[model samples]
Target: MKYKNPVISGFHPDPSICKVGENFFLVTSSFEYFPGIPIFQSKNLVNWEQIGHVLTREAQLPLKREHSFIPSQGIFAPTIRYHKGRFYVITTNITIRKTFYVWAEHPEGPWSDPIFIDGFRGYDPSLFFDDNDKVYITGASFPGAGPEGIFQAELDIDSGKMISESQFVWEGTGGSSPEGPHLYKINDWYYLLVAEGGTEYGHMVTIARSRKPYGPFESNPHNPILSNRSTKLPIQATGHADLIQASDGTWWAVFLGFRPVKSTKVHHLGRETNLAAVEWSEEGWPVIGENGRAKVEHDAKLLLVNEPTPWLERDDFNCESLATVWNFYRNPLESSWSLTEQQGFLTLYGQSCTLNDLESPTFVGRRQQHFNCEVSTLMEFSPTEEGEEAGLTVFMNENYHYDIAKMIQKGQTIILFRCRVGSLWKVVKEILYDEPSVVLKIKATDTSFTFSYATPTGEEKVIGSGETSLLSTQIAGGFTGLYFGLYATGNGKCSTAPAHFDYFQYVPGQE
Candidate 1:
């Protein structure tokens, strides 16, 4: 089955893909979002499944304080490749302003700690290994060098290190601003593919070919092989591509595009992943899409064999380790979160005194996919002092978030819904309940959200409701999806009470 619009939709952007035998794997740059790069697998180019994130452990990629809260600025344009019995991925942390690489024997891995490359050289770095066992690293231009262009250098695969100094190979045709450069060898020619015209309205996939790995490559006559018809269409920003050939010799390319809701230009869902077919032309250039433009929909006949189970939505909490679906807001202290016994309850220990601070240590989260849904969790409390709160929240960045939480005030539980915009947090609703345990439920429809609570007798009452517009990336301005989660922290000690999450579910429909 082919997904017409989004094969892997909604903020799953800057797709880099590769095929090993009959199997295919795709990865996306996760920016500052922890559990860095998400690894997706697809048998056919159309359907994709989230295998896991490449950086589960902090050792894989070291994230600092400044880059942690802002998810968009940390990681950009990750390129994944499988070679010589190992999977290698090279990416740039624009915040840290450096490039690093990691490898694993398997795709869903215990990947090695990052091997930081030597120079503070490039951005959007990609790897290409030649047929004669020569390894090369190619990337887009950096600040000090020439104008926006593509550069290539030799590399040592084993050490994840660069061999010789890089040289400028292609300057792009006159006015074209080429970025996201990836190299491939085909039919005795090294083809350099790049995304030009910036990452905005005029974005496109252009190609230049050379007979040698490092040489004077010539641009294709039909410059843009794949692009949206820029003639007044709302959807724009359609480039930054990576290509792969299947076991059956079928070629495909994955790139990024943005479809705005109200406006024709800006993308609130961030850059979306798009797929297109490529064919080698008789004249030796690649012909992309069907008529040389990205097909707005997918071809059903080109679909492949297997289907993918995207991600694990439900957790029984009956395991010692946490599920891969959970990611910390910042790099986490592994000791801070754990499952109590082999039961269906997950416990988050308190670290930060308040949820409003960037240095807070509390881990609060839920996955970023799915549209309309409901999430509920129960917390048992034995608070000795005031200011200990535990509750549910919808978070975008540290600057924008809204939550409904219950805190202990002189042995009483106070439920309050608070929203944070910029640095201001205002209480929207408040209720005082004399209950030790209460169930908190948040129902999210297509446009708005409502919160309700129960007395454990299944008798529930509505507490607060508002526009879920806070979940938009436009207001928050980050390269990540909105997350809802359970949290606990602040000025008191919690003992003898287990935080229980009965179940979390998502049912599609407008209610």
Candidate 2:
């Protein structure tokens, strides 16, 4: 069976997986976005559905501006593992420099509060349950900790304590930033897999093995078992992988990779989850993809499905709560947004904090899943105050974003198109409008994004457009990608009026 590379698409990075019975559960890193660590389930390797998020509450995942908030500074790499009957997810909160784990009976859960791992100081943690019922925690060593490598310690899962001193296991094959380590015990050998080369164009996955869980391990003769660096493949930056064995005794790998715009190394859709078949060598080493390279299309012999699970392209706000795809900028105040306040519409009260601020604002968004797609929203908002505004935005963090909104400028209602690139901020276009309701749209292409607006009467007009490269990771300098956001802000003062969104739609275009 042939399937696409990115089994799970868009801004979902640091892919990790764990199998229980016949079901597979996966997780990916969510940085600076509320409801962090999205959990997904799959029956077939090519098809996956988001069951829920591990960090759904503010208590479980606190993302606040006061903690020196920055883009790509909250949740890092996460590894999901199933032990006995309970599911465990361990990750790092880089903002607080803390490593913690949470557990639940089921993947879609009432997960327990974080059990902080004392004496463990690193990122990308993984849990290994040996045949003797003993649990071990392995993770990348903290930077400047003498030598960089993978560390391991005996863990008391109940108390989150390290029973033994942490020890360095394998230092990889000398690639930079040896992180995202996963340990597996296969046939009397403990194999250590880690991603190296800094997760950019040079990203790669390498492995080693030892008789014991801790050191005296030897690197794979074919080190960097998986990578796409310097290749012309559509999928690039391939690494940070997790391996799972199927019911048929076949091994597979789920990893993170990105699809750059044609002829350019710029990708704004972010690192996505990719699947590849794995086979063991005669020497008991694993070989991934086609000679360590991921493809845009690949083959798998598992029980194939007719089609992958479909995503909802249009949200009408008819449900009692926001869909699982929606995410806030940070820890959003409960009072700032509501679905029941104005039945059949998502109502967002304009908060004093604007999108430009590092603080939490009344903003809700989803990842940009396609290179060429259309995103639009029908919003009803009448701004009486000068700073009050509500509309659609293609956001790439505080300093890099493009906005098409209706605001009160110089005592007159106007439709504004603005761009913020680093230190440069400019109002590219604006038009006088007295309408209280309007539709704001953004049409994205491989190279640019076109902003337009339509009045209630249904006449659409092009406001302006901006270069898509402006929001690329190469220029923005962040681990996150672009987000299609619906935001309401007051710049500095709270607005008495509220914005109501009738519907939000994202339609992907054929390549």
Candidate with best TM-score: 2
The CA lDDT of each predicted structure is: 0.73, 0.90
Q: How far is 131's C-alpha from truth in model 1 (Å)?
A: 1.3
Error of 2 at 236 (Å): 0.7
lDDT of 1 at 197: 82
> Against the hidden reference, what TM-scores do the models get?
0.87, 0.98
Lowest summed lDDT across 10 adjacent residues in model 2 is found at 63-72
Residue range 119-166, candidate 1, lDDT tens digits: 737888999988889999999888666656888889988787778888
Q: Pick out the ten consecutive residues of candidate 1 with the lowest summed lDDT.
A: 260-269
As a whole number from 0 to 100, the lDDT of residue 476 in candidate 1 is 66
RMSD of 2: 1.1
Instruction: Provide C-alpha RMSD values for all models, in order.
Output: 3.4, 1.1
Candidate closest to the true structure, highest lDDT: 2
TM-score of 1: 0.87
